[model samples]
Target: MIEFECIQCGTSLRVENRHAGRTAWCRRCKRPVLVPVNATPIADQPDEFPTPVPPAQPVARPYFEPSQPPALEEPQETAMPAPVKRGPIQAMDTDPRNAALLAEIERRGRVIAQLTAEVEALRQAAESRAREGDLLEAELAAARKMALSGVQDTGRERAMIEELNAIISTQRELLVEKDEKIYKLDAALRRATRYSAETDGNTELPDVPRTLEDQTEAGGYEEGAEGGDARANVELDEARRLAQHRSLEIRSLRNALDDMAAKFDRVTVELRNAVLKLTETQQDNERLVSELASARDRLREKEFEGERFSTEPAQAPAESMEPALLEESLSSPVQVEVRPEPVWATAPVPRPEPVRAYSPPVTTPASDMPAQPATDIQHDQRVLVDALLRFLGRR
Candidate 1:
């Protein structure tokens, strides 16, 4: 880039290095002047006269702004003034002052022409800048207004996040309380098992032959252990019955506890995921709010700039403002891609197991007790499982 003073009015003008030794109009004086190969504009030097009066600028600018004007080459050096040819008497009659006056008139005319061209350039540039400023202001206003309307959406998002947080907290509390209850129930089950085992151990050995008829009569039934096999003991059969009942009860309780525990775990995991989603939604809302604020600020600043440009013509130069406006584009905030959080159904907790009353131990000798058939034991287990399944189905 190069900068130089216009000799006619002392207005500092700037140009690219390619414009050196070429003629361009002085923005202040409207006179043609030459740019130097290496020069600097003195910012402190004021123009000798006010800028030339501008004619109305071209209103129909193309969609794309035009490039910089071509430089005006030095016309004086290439086309030298022609020599006057006069006859001897006529030349003598011509006044010397008249010749000087004619030359002055020609110089003034060139100056007037240069001033007119410079004025036109300034006018065109000013109009373009004004139009661009108006467009920018419009864009900024529309963008800001759009973002402002989303304030309600942002508030709703925030409220939903808070609501989710509250729900998650309550669920966590319920889970903790339920876990405590489960722990207590487990401890009670263990104690019950130990008590049942101790009661079984304290029983005395039974005399099966003597007590067989008596025990069968006491129960109001006269069935043998294995349907008339003499070796099948009646006392042993009674003990096996009690053991089967206890085993079934224990199995049902354990299964129910396990199912409940698993459900709790699944519920906890789902609640945690919900919390994560809520946190993400909160972050998005915050970002959206920030964007809205910035857009509003930008709109206000642009509105001020537009007002100042429209009102003050002295500060806006046709040449300087054109390049600046060409580089600038209207800015607006882009909204983030937001989505609603989803709710999922979780696994259900099983109902509590029903408690069974403890049975009294039967008096029988372990060495002499008859072994129950595997098939009978399996059949009893299946019946217990079926009962428990039915109970669960109702719930």
Candidate 2:
């Protein structure tokens, strides 16, 4: 017999032997399915009398029974099998396999213990390494940050340097302008000096020609006739006067030129010195600025070093002993004297005397006293007495 089921509905199907190798439809679902030759038919007959179904109950059972009072059946004794002859018993210590096994177990245990210790050590080492790595990472981050800060600071410093350089360049340009102005002024003064010198030299040349011209003009007769010689002398005098006036004007002009040249030279020298001093001052200022920056850098380095020193951990107690040892090795003892002395050893100082103010004595007026006759007094005596009286009165 063969079993057949509907593919779609999973329903059992039965077919006659003659209907083998034929297609059929499910009776329940009406699904087409193939019928096999060996299909078994499910029985559908009902029992004539039905048996009562038992009610569900809990099964009560015990794993083990209690001891029995006695056995009801006689126990039968079967023949025991004869013991087989065997080799002499071997001592556990003499068993190489067991010993080897135990040794191997011990070795394995030791290996396991070592491995466990190593694992624990590795764990601690890993933890330490991790901590170290974390610290290093933090340090690296800090260093990176510091480096970036340094780079920024460097950029700022570079900018500051550029600004300073620009300022210096501007100052230099100003100095160059000042120098140019000074040079121009000096050249001007030099030209003025040469001009004044030439003028002075020409002035000193002589009043000889002017004096001769005046003498000749004075000796010559004038055109208007009066007393001829007298008129001529008068006209000549006037001409000599005119010639003197002209000479005086020339002298004045020469003096004026000399004075102007002196003034120019003086001003030029002063300006030149001033320019030199200004340049010196500027150089000094730059030197001072450099010194100030160096001092600040040193101060910052010292502060950083101090911070590092303060942040470092203290030395161990054993390490601290070296200072004591050094102290002992280098120690020296010296006797100190104990002296007793009077607390008031020095003499008392003398006090200064008070100053006294002078008071002037009062004098009665001369009018209140008797006056001597003026007739009795000689002229010389009167002058002397008046002088003496005036001196005394003033005093």
Candidate 3:
């Protein structure tokens, strides 16, 4: 028997020598291969110990029809080969074709492993890129929202500025109107003060003259204290200017009224001094009227003396006339002359002085006038003159 290895699979086999150098299929690998002719058969060796090999059993081939294996023929055992010249020839290396097949298998295995590792790395890269894309989308959405909010805030600020401008303009107009009102009030107050002062000094209102000049100076202090001190300082300056203007006007009016009253008192004093001169002129006129009445009384006495002379001659009876004629008298008109003195032309005017009257004539018809009657007449003349003087003074 000869023993050999299957070139494709390395499985051991025992075969007859006739099968050497033949092409056959390996039972385990199922691939066709050539057997080497230079191989040493195991049965050809001489051994110090001989071991028997089991017989090979027949195997069925699924690819062919059933057939019987060839029977082995008996042969004499062979002797061992002579000693080798260089040592026993080393066993030949495996078949070149078989070695080539084994190398190709190893190369294929390495290629499969490398391809698997590359596929795993590519899968991890894809997952990382997807996560990054999701994060970028969220950031873009936030930026858009912020831009919209900024635009809304800008529009609101514009509207607020416009409202403030309108309010400021209205305040300016109100200030102008207020200034006009203040000017009108000041002018009216000044006119009233001046007119009152020009009128009769006693006829002015008691409090109004004082208040118009001073109220602005004295009032508003309470309001200033209630408000803040900073604002009060500004208003106080304006109040001071107004008070000064009013005070000056009031002072001028008061001075004018005092001068007019003083001049009127002086004129009244001069008129009172003229009264003594007027009393003397009235006494001289009364004396002239009393002398005229006495002359009329003397003319009656002269007429009675003439009548007695004529009646005594007629009683002698030489120049006899009718006795009835003695009781009658011739009718004749008598002339009396009166001399008049103008009292006003000759009267002397002098400053006020003392006066005294010594005697006064009486015009009443009596045989003799009593001193009591003349005294009464003089007293009555003095009373009449005083009444007339008083009436003139009043006028």
Candidate 4:
């Protein structure tokens, strides 16, 4: 006999007949079973065969050789079945297990709903972040364009700074040269002033009578003759006084010129020093500006590196690891102190004293005589008077 077992539950089915082909059902589980023929027996039990039943007789039909016409039958229409009605949901007034399972299902449904909401929120956040990233990318592109423009500007500025420095250096050199020139000019002016003073003092002397006896003897003539001589003598004295006054005026002028020259020399020296100090100030300014530019460049580089690190996720480690140290290092302000150059007070150049114009009196024969001489003295006196008058007029 062939044995068959249920595949799902592993239950054996019993067969009543042992035939070539037999079909049966399992008694434990109400399912159909089929037995295979030519089966092996278990535990030495012989295979049993069932007795065959009699066959049913078939009725005989008359044979005809004629062609028949087929008749068409009317098609029957089947009624459509109604949809099945569902019963109302039962309330939770029954078993605790059912209530618990329903509650668990409801809880799981709520949890699923919450999870779905969280997923939607996360998706929205991701979308927002993507939009923000797009905006940031546009801004970054604009910033990069601006940065390139700034670099060009920086080059221009650097060139300008270099040009300015060159100009300042040239100016400083010119200032030094000017100072030297001023010093030389001052020395030359001082020497010229001293020479002028000496020349003015030694140039000429006034023509004055040498002896008082000449005046007394010339006064001893008759009233009418002495009157004319006395008038002439008075005129000569007035001429001498006028000449002395001129000499005094020339001495005053020389003194004034010397004083002016001395003042000019002192002024020139001061001006030269002022120019030098100004040049130094300009140089200092250039140096400070260069230092400031270097500091700013370093600051810009630091900012660029910081921005680059901030923008890239992979570079975030560098930002986080030493931000304080970097900030502390970068944020310190550079102090540049420019000390003012000292300006020394220049002393006044002393003017040389005015030189007096003096000359030794020369004795004449007429001025030395005690009595009048008789050798055409009137003609000689007339000649002398004419010469004196001419000299006074020329002066």
**The best candidate in terms of TM-score:** 1
lDDT per residue for candidate 3 within 1-395, as digits (tens), equals: 56678866799766667878887677899887676676667655456447689999999977977899899999989999897565221221232323322343343344333323323332332233234334333433443354445445445544554554554455446545555655665665455454444432444333332675466544454354335344444444455466566455545544544554454355344433333333343343334334323322432343233233223221122123333332221121211111232232122211111112222221222223222222222333344335434433533
Give all TM-scores, in the order shown: 0.29, 0.27, 0.23, 0.27
By TM-score, the better pick of 1 and 3 is 1
Off by over 4 Å in 2: 1-103, 204-395
lDDT for each residue of candidate 1 in 214-256, tens digit (9 for 90 to 100): 7766454324322433322333454455455555655665565
lDDT of 4 at 304: 50
Q: Return the clash pairs for model 3, or none.
A: none
lDDT of 2 by residue, 1-395 (tens): 24588878989777665667898889999777888766674434434445689999999987887887985998899999998775433343454334433343344344333333333433343333334334434544554465456556555655655665565566556556655655655555555555545544553322333677765654442322225445445555554565556556546655655665565566556556655554554454344345434434543453454344334332222232244443432342322121222221111111111111112222221222343232211232233334334333432
Comparing 3 and 4 by TM-score, which wins? 4
Ranking by TM-score: 1, 2, 4, 3
Model 1 reaches what TM-score against the true structure? 0.29
lDDT of 2 at 352: 16
Report how far residue 16 has shifted in candidate 4, in Å. Answer: 91
Taking the tens digit of each residue's C-alpha lDDT, what string does model 4 give over 227-273? 65555555555555655565565566556556655655665565566
Q: Number of backbone collisions per candidate, in order?
A: 0, 4, 0, 0
Considering lDDT, where higher is better, how would the candidates rank from best to worst?
Answer: 1, 2, 4, 3
Query: What is the clash count of model 3?
Result: 0
